[model samples]
Target: MVLAYLLSVIFTQPVVTMEAEAIQPVALRPVANLKAKDTPNDAGQSIDLSWELSPDSARVKRYEVYRAESAKGPFEKIVEFLVPTTAYTDADTLLRNKKDYYYRVDVVGELESRASSEIAGPVQAKPEWFNTNRIPVLVFAVVYGLLLILYIEFAKRDREMFVRRIAGLDAIDEAVGRSTEMGKPILFSFGIGYLTDVATLAALSILRRVARRAAEYETRILVPNYDPIVMTAAQETVKQAFSEAGRPDLYQEGDITFLTADQFGYAAGVNGIMLREKPGTVFLQGVFYAEALILAETAHSVGAIQIAGTNMATQLPFFIAACDYTLIGEELFAASAYLDRDPQLLGSLKSEDIAKLITVGLIVVVSVVGTIGAVLTSVSGESGILRSLTEFFNSGFERLVSFLTTS
Candidate 1:
């Protein structure tokens, strides 16, 4: 009986040992050499994280990275199922200033272990002066500066800058001369528009020049306005122009008169003046609406030499048909610089011309290259040289355009 019992015990012991070995858990080593870097975006809101996978977990499915507010943390997983070779970027939009954060990485497999990497300290990146989006703006500034310099150089030589004669300006002296010959007052109407509008300001500038001439010729100028602010500015401008011409006494307050704030009402008053005064010269230089035709036709009937200038696209055709001379959109603004010969304004105009030239050149190049590229793409031919040349030129032209626009 004792021998039989010993045999059974030995067999049972071997069986127990085999079962325990089969159930033994795999040991997971801590991930090694963790690193963090500031994100390149310069938003001060992100960091890049990287680490080495443990040898034991090499065959494991994925890794997990954890973050915590403190070193001894109830760590929370920030990223999971991450490939061992891949680095992760963490963008913490909720990050608070001067706050501490800790990070650790763990290797996870079929059988997970408690081992993890040493916690990394909180890191903060300083804000940058420029953002990525500002690159275009910087490029533009450089191009603009170069263009401005070129314009200044050209202006300094007193070179005869050729500007196409604006029909409206050409009619100015003629209108005043006609008024002088006819011995009739010249009716000047600065349409009801705000001072801040570019068209209104252009009109004002033209008014000063016309008023000076009217003063010199001893021709009466009657200005009807629709805006209070415009009325005030027009009065001041006409008065100054008259004073500049040494005809201060000839400046009449009633001449730079305010009609009404209402557009139609002001138009009626202007029409009435056109009929009643029957002035030999009529100057319309401001923003006008449907009322433009009415005023122009009325002035035409009175046999006045009409000169109109405006930037309103809708009203341009009517003025063109009815007025003896009319200033177009950009031409109206150019006239101010032409008459005044302001260095800054003239420089700006020159820059604009350079910009236009660059734009046209780019358009032509793009059209030609695009056609070539399309033809090459359609044919299954080796277009390596053509492709490379086109790409190079396109990139260069784009950069040049960006520079000009920003500068």
Candidate 2:
């Protein structure tokens, strides 16, 4: 009986061991056709790797990427993916330019069982002079540059370049004259903007024109600033304008004064000046925020003719509501060219308009094609002719949209 029991136990133990070995996880198959190449249209120090998925992809837990300086190498693990993947870009900072790189991809399975592909190597990363993806942008830039040169030559030859009249800018002389007639001060506020802002810079150009006009009219102009730097610039600009107007003695340094840097504080100060001095004209030009309406409303209350301009879209509505003349976004930027009529500036502005026309035309064409494609796709009942037309329009639309977005 004891011998029989011992025999049965030995037989059962061997069977249990065999069943356990059968149920153990197997090593996943390695990925195939691994390829590595220099990344296109990019600066050096990047390599693109691609490979075929493993036959045992169902069993794969993750993919691991290993990189080395040479084919026969101590490869360092660079990256890993928890899900199945076939491509990776090794853009690690440690990768040096013009250096050869070798790569291997491993398909890892449950219990860390892994199979590695044959190493792909001898690929070097090099920078391209120009990115093909940005060719559209390059073309646009070249065209704009050529247009600028052409228009500049025309302007230099005294050819008349047409510019639309901006009523706000045209009214500057009128505003200054009214102030002179009423015996009231002309107030200009650079609304809570630093000297670094483009809106503020544009405002400086407009201020120069206004200051020159005021000097000619012998009107007292008050410039209240939110920034000290802006105040200094305003002083210099006014001084220059006064000299140009042949009224250097009329330029008062005290008029272009810096108020508190705080947004609301500056608004309160300017509002107080408007109320007390009863300025005949108020120019609110530059960057503005919540204080825009406050200042504009106060100037309105004091019976001031307000001319407002800003690039801030959020504050434009308030300015338009309260001010007599509002210079919308691009109009404010075009002030320097309009006021100065510099040949170079006028040429640049003309080129900008041409570019805008081209952009708008492309947008319209793309929208028409995409809409037609979508409509045909929804209605066509597997007709060959309709399918062909749909493909043509959709592909064209997609390409154009992609180009526009990338450019």
Candidate 3:
């Protein structure tokens, strides 16, 4: 009886030990110190993370990094299954100021081990320095500013400023004159886009110039628009232009009409207007889509001198093929300044050119240096002064660029 009781106790002891072992939590250890720092290129935000190779991680698999807006967090995992590494960088961009962020790291092996550390303090980052990525932009800005001053000075002195004739613009007078001779109204379509679109603004600028010329010629100008806002704005702009030309009485609201908002519907309506009015000139300006070809084709069929301008690269080719003259991307904007002879606008154009020159120079330098570096590395099997020179030039230029942009 005594032997039987002792054997039973031994079996029970094993079961109790096994149950305790199963319920016990595994320990997690941190391999690196947790660090927090402000993120670059933003208003204000901080990132907190750590690196660690867990002893049990080989069996367990990955790690989880948890974050809480407050120190007491109902902590939630920000990163899950992170591979073991010596460092991690937090790159969250949208964190606001004064908002505390707490973090904790956990080693998750075959199963989840206990968190390595307690929840970190609620910390927030203040807005740091402005980014320097816009150095090239600043340089261009300065160059343009100087050019504008010079142009304005020349304008004050009544000095003749020579500008190259833009084919698209030079045809405007002829287009309006043709309509007058034919006794047909001119049709102008501000392409399908919002009033605030850059292309729409460009179209409006040109329209003002066109309206002034049309008013002086006593020619009827018809504008069909798809966007209600644009339609309203176009009416105002045309009226203003006619008024400025001392022919406000000639301005008619009926001349500026609103077509359907549908893309194809607008195109069809404009095409019909072209067919019925037999307008001698059709000005298609602003943003356009597939309807561009359809409108251009219809205008061409009517024997009208079609002038089109748009920034959309894809639509440019269609315009080039169909229209008599097309204003490519930046030209659309530049044309307005050119027509108005606005010093500020001209200045901006000059600045844009300077930026382009700088960009091209940098590209050429980088390409040459990179090719030389590759060839030297392959042939010499060792780095020399040539290699050092190449690296210095590339790195120095990059750093200078970065500083300018960041500043």
- Model 3: per-residue Cα lDDT over 1-407, one tens digit each: 99999999988999999988877756656544555555555667656455556556555456667777877668877676655664555556666666778777776643355546556556676666666556566776776567667666655666655566688987888888988898877888888989879999989999998999999999999999999999999999999999999999999999798999999999999999999888888999999999999999999999988999999999999999999989888878877878888665665555556556766776676567556656655555247886676666567666555644453
Ten consecutive residues with minimal summed lDDT in candidate 1? 373-382
Choose 1 or 3, whichever is better by lDDT: 1
lDDT by residue for model 1 over 239-318, one digit each (tens)? 99999999999999987788898888988999999899899999888888888998999999989888888888999999
lDDT of 2 by residue, 1-407 (tens): 99999999988999999889877879678999999999999988899999999999998989999999889888999999988899999998888889888999999987788999999998999989989998889988898889888888888888888999999988888888888899899999989999999999999999999999999999989999989999999999999999999999999999999889998889889988998999999999999999999999999999889999999999999999999999998899999999889988898888889889999999999999999999989977676889899889989999999989987
lDDT values for all models: 0.79, 0.92, 0.78
RMSD of each: 11.4, 4.2, 5.5
Candidate 3: worst-modelled 10 consecutive residues by lDDT: 109-118
Residue 71 miss distance in model 3 (angstroms): 8.0
TM-score of 2: 0.81
- Candidate with best lDDT: 2
Clashes of each: 4, 0, 11
Model 1 TM-score, all chains together? 0.60
For each candidate, give its TM-score against the true structure: 0.60, 0.81, 0.77
Ranked by TM-score, the better of candidates 2 and 3 is 2
The prediction achieving the highest TM-score against the true structure is 2
Residue 205 lDDT (model 2): 97
